[model samples]
Target: MHINFPLILVIAVAVAGLLALLDLVWLAPRRRRVIAAYQAQVDTPDPQTLERLDKEPLLVEYGKSFFPVLAVVLILRSFLVEPFQIPSGSMKPTLEVGDFILVNKFAYGIRLPVVDTKVFDVGDPQRGDVMVFRYPNEPRINYIKRVIGLPGDHIRYADKQLYVNGEPVPRDLMRTEPDDEVPPGHPLQSLAKVDIYEEYLEDSAHLIRHKRLSQPARPQEWLVPEGHYFMIGDNRDNSNDSRYWQSDQMPRELWGMVPDNYIVGKAFAVWMHWPEPKLSNLPSFSSISLIH
Candidate 1:
């Protein structure tokens, strides 16, 4: 089962803050009065007696200790930035499995965590940005993909080529080579060779890949509705992106479009890569670089 981490964090912060506030307003003053009365009765209270009188309840002590730290984490994660680990090759050649990346939370706009309601309009996603968003069909799950179409934009995918607003997006074949990064036993491994291309989307230039000799995906087209965006993965042939969101559970009209509210943040940089969890394989910082 998926854990709603944001909700949990918010609840923890609230509870901790409440306990601390209760101690400050009521319990702490009462303790102070008791200590003062004891001091009035005795000529000189020993250090041990004072310490015992001033001691806080265990629950209140824990709450005061944890509230500040939790508040800082919530602010940074909900508004500034958050780390994510890539779990699939859907964004291959750009992001690989186990690649840890940082997403700019306010890049698109600042939204209230858990509820996901945008309270400010910082900016809208531009074409060619690598965006992390909630899967429209299942908002609990997050997916990362490149922005392909904006509101009112027309997008077409045919013959493994992409078109935006009726113009063919330029893609130059760089090479056809073996991808050593392809995970073992992956379906794409059967197609040993992969074609690498430099696709230019607007001013952004990024590399994409397609399996050599693999059958082309069926052509598809989408007209992005207002308040929605179209997303596609860089691993053209291997991604489950806007081109193939059709499923029995989703309505036909909402299949290929991601709503604006589903936007999480813009993926800006990859900080590390550890392809597996074995102790022998340590995470490497060599892959640290800004996302194109």
Candidate 2:
């Protein structure tokens, strides 16, 4: 099960902030009074008065010191930028497994952290933008995909080709190369005969993978509704996207166009990448670069 980290952070901040406020309003004044009283009777202070002046609850001390730091982190993560690690190859050439990316939280406008209510009119996501959002099927889990269709767009995917508003998106084949076996430990290791193509979406060109022998399933055409978007993965055949999510196994929540409010952030850059099972000769800075 996915953990609701944002909700947890919100709850933590509220609790800590409350404790800190209480300490400032009530506890601190009480402590000061006890200290003043003891000081006034310093020459012959009673044991009870001295004890009251010296002792402090550990919880109060922690709340005073930690609450400010937590509040700052909450503000930064919720509105400025947040870091995320890529866990799957759905975005492959654009984003890879183990790549740590920074998402621009305010790029699509600022939103309340846990509830995700957008409060500012920053900007809308354009076609070809890579976005991270809560998975519709499971709201707690996050998913990343490229926006292919904006509001009022007629999107079609047939025979592994894309069409927008009845015009075929230009795809210049850079080259066709032999496919690679799905690496060990991959979920789709059973898939075979994969081919790679360098396809361009508008001026932003990127690589995509497809299975040569397998026919594209369920040719689809969708008229994107207002305030909703159509998204797809760069790994066309291997991805579970808006075009191929009507399975009975998938919950109804996971189906249909993604709402604008569901967007989390625009994925801007890859800050770092580290391959698993660390190798000695691995190029340290090979994957350290800006994301397309």
Candidate 3:
């Protein structure tokens, strides 16, 4: 089952805050008064009264210490920055499986947690920016991809080439051999051809992988809708992105553009890349580097 972590955090904060308030406003004062009255009646307090005076309530102690920390985490992650891991090769070369990346939450704007309603507008996503967003098909699941088409822009993918606004994007071939570093049993391992290229986007350039053995989806063009964006994975043939959406397999909600409110953040850096269990002995930092 999918656990809703944000909701859990919110609940934790509320419960902790309530326990702390109860102790501060009523329980602690009442206990102190009772202990003081018992002390006045005898030269030395009884074992029961002494125990009560010395022992701190577990709930109240924990609440008072943990609430502030949890509140700070919630605010920072929701507004400033958040971290994510790449689990697939959809953005290979630029991002790889096992890479832990930090996303700039305020780059696009600040949004309330859980509800994801954008409350501020710092900036809009630019072309070539790597982004994390709620999957259009499932709002609860997050996906990462590069922004290819902005609102009102036209995008076309054909013959393994990308076109934006009637201009063809440029690319330089980097390699043709299958990447030996690809994890064993990975889907890319069985592919006959793996081509890597440095594709130049409107503003920046990044590496992309192409699988020659896989059949290309028919060329398609899309006109991005207002307040929405078009995205595509860097691994062109292997990724199930905006290029191919079958009505039978996907809900109508994923027809084309991703709603603006669905954006999570802009992914900017790769902080770590631990070795996968399948290749534990291999160099863990083979793919460790800053993301473009």
Candidate 4:
């Protein structure tokens, strides 16, 4: 299962913020009074001296630390584009499994955190543009794919080719990038992954690897419903996108219909790489754990 990083960040921040607020409201004032009262008892040292329990000041210290950190993280993740590491080769070539990518959080405009309600106007996903968005099925999950179908357009996939608005999305084969698999009896051959064949996703396109000659073979047609989009991966045959699961609905609340508010941003470049050094070098969450 995909790790819900954003949700985790949100929850951690929110809980810390709540605790901080509670201390300010209920505990801070009480601690002051209790401390003052204990001082009074110390001064008197009468026969019926009352001893107060020690409040370790734990909540105050933690609130001071965690609350600020969480708040900053919340604001950054919500307003600015957040960095993400590709855990799979779903976006191979353009984005390898280990590439660290930055999402344009404000590209689609700023939105409230948690609720994810967009309150400003920014921009829309253009044809052939790569986008990262909250997976509608689960907003807690983020899925990166190229935006193929916009609202009110016809999109189809058959024989590993994309059909948009009754026209085939064209691809001009460039050259096959070297496959990463090392020849047998050589060194560790796990890094054999390579950008198979380069193809223009249209006029404005990106490079991708198909692993083999076979691409996606879904023969289906779809009308890009209003407020919805048709998404597909540059690695056609291997993508589970609108064609396979059918076009997804992009409603604002579901975060599935990826309202502009849910737009994370465009990925620009790679930042790091790490081969699994196991049977397969493609990085996984477990690999990221090892990285940690």
Candidate 5:
């Protein structure tokens, strides 16, 4: 089952804050009054007795201790930056599996957590940006892909070439090399070799890869409606992205596009890579670099 982390965080912060507030408003005052009455009855106030009287209830104490930390985490994660791990090679050569990347949460806008209502407009996503967004078919799942088309743009992919607004996007072949990173028993491992290319999406230039002998996908075209975007993976033929989202099973209006509201953030940088969970293998920081 998918856990609603943001919702859980918000609830924890609220409960903790309430507990602290309860101690400040009701319990602490009552304790102070009792201590004062006892001190007035005795000739000398005992420090031990005063300390015991002033001690907070365990639940309240824990709540007060945790509130500030939880609040700060919520604010930072929801508005500033959030960390994510790449789970697949959909963005191969750009982002590898196990890469820990930081997403700029406020790059697109400031949206309230859980409910995801945008309260502030910072900016809209630009072409060529690597973005993370909730899957259109399943909002609970997050998927990352490159932004290919903005609202009202024409997008077409034919013969493995991408065309935006009737112009074919430029690409330069870099090299043909064996993919050593392919996991064991993967189908792509049988391909033997792949072609690497530097694709130019406006001013941003990024590397993309395609299996040398793999069959090309069926030609497709899309008109990006207002408030929606066209996204495609940097792995080209291997990615399950906006290109494949359109199907007879789905409604036409909801086909092959990422709605503005489903956007999470722009992936800015990769900080670490730990592909395997084995204790013998350690994570490496050598891949740390700003994402294109």
Candidate 6:
């Protein structure tokens, strides 16, 4: 059977902590005084007493040292904020591979740790928010992507243009050239360079390299079912998202259409970029466009 690691951690920490707490709050004083008095009486610990005492300190030590740290992590990751690392180029230009990001735990709603059940009231995701969430297929694993469609939105992707509820979501040609260095692919050699002109997401428009050189016959139209969301990568043509996978093939373990529960939080800003020089040479954070 598959074991859930987070649940195991929580259970282990809880059990170890409760045992330790019992020892400290209820048993320590009494045991210590008894040991002292008995030692005075016998002047030496008997073999059985010595054997029992031998194991107590080790358990006490293990509980004392690790339980608090585990509990703190469980609380912080469960309630307030959690950090994650970007492992792929699925979000390339906006969030490069190796980028570390912070996800607001309470942004969508407060969820109990491990269980993912929402507890309190919270806000919903807007059009352009970059969000992190638990992959519906498996809550143990986390996935991050941009939120593109909401519930009941008749989302359509044809010839590279996004039509939401039949209204063409605006997009513009920013610059056209080989973005080969940008993503290591040759898609730019044939596609149009589209800049996201909306402000619902980032202030500076995110560049979506589209190779839409044709007429799309219902290229992809989806009536975003309830509770699930339509997700896409900043890299445009490169992401494996709602566009490619059919609903039945998508296990409920994956995010259902417009699932408010799958959402974890809205990403706010870039805290740090490494090799530091890349961001250092660029314009100030104020000048950076939060366009898409």
TM-score of decoy 3: 0.87
Better of 1 and 4 by TM-score: 1
Tens-place lDDT digits, model 3, residues 3-28: 77888988898898998889889988
Per-residue alpha-carbon lDDT of candidate 2 for residues 28-114, written as tens digits (9 for 90 to 100):
789888788767867877878677676667887777788888889899899998999888888876787788889999999989999
lDDT of each: 0.91, 0.81, 0.83, 0.65, 0.92, 0.66
Winner on TM-score between 2 and 4 is 2
Task: Write one digit per residue (lDDT tens) for candidate 5, span 197-250.
Answer: 999999999999988767887898999999999999999968889888545554
Clashing pairs in 4: 104-264, 104-265, 136-256, 180-192, 181-192, 216-237, 249-257, 250-257, 251-257
Candidates in order, TM-scores: namely 0.94, 0.86, 0.87, 0.68, 0.94, 0.72
Regions more than 4 Å wrong, model 3 = 43-51, 179-191, 246-254, 275-288
Look at candidate 5 and tell me the lDDT of residue 275: 90
| lDDT tens digits, residue span 152-179, model 1 | 9999989999999999999999988886
Q: How accurate is candidate 3 locally (lDDT)?
A: 0.83
CA lDDT for candidate 1: 0.91
Sort by lDDT, best first. Answer: 5, 1, 3, 2, 6, 4
The worst-scoring run of ten residues by lDDT in candidate 2 lies at: 172-181
Model 5 alpha-carbon drift over 4 Å, by segment? 180-191, 245-255
TM-score of candidate 6 against the unseen true structure: 0.72
> How many residue pairs clash (N, CA or C atoms closer than 3 angstroms) in each of the candidate models, in the order given?
0, 0, 0, 9, 0, 22
List RMSD in Å for every model shown: 2.3, 3.9, 3.3, 7.5, 2.4, 6.3
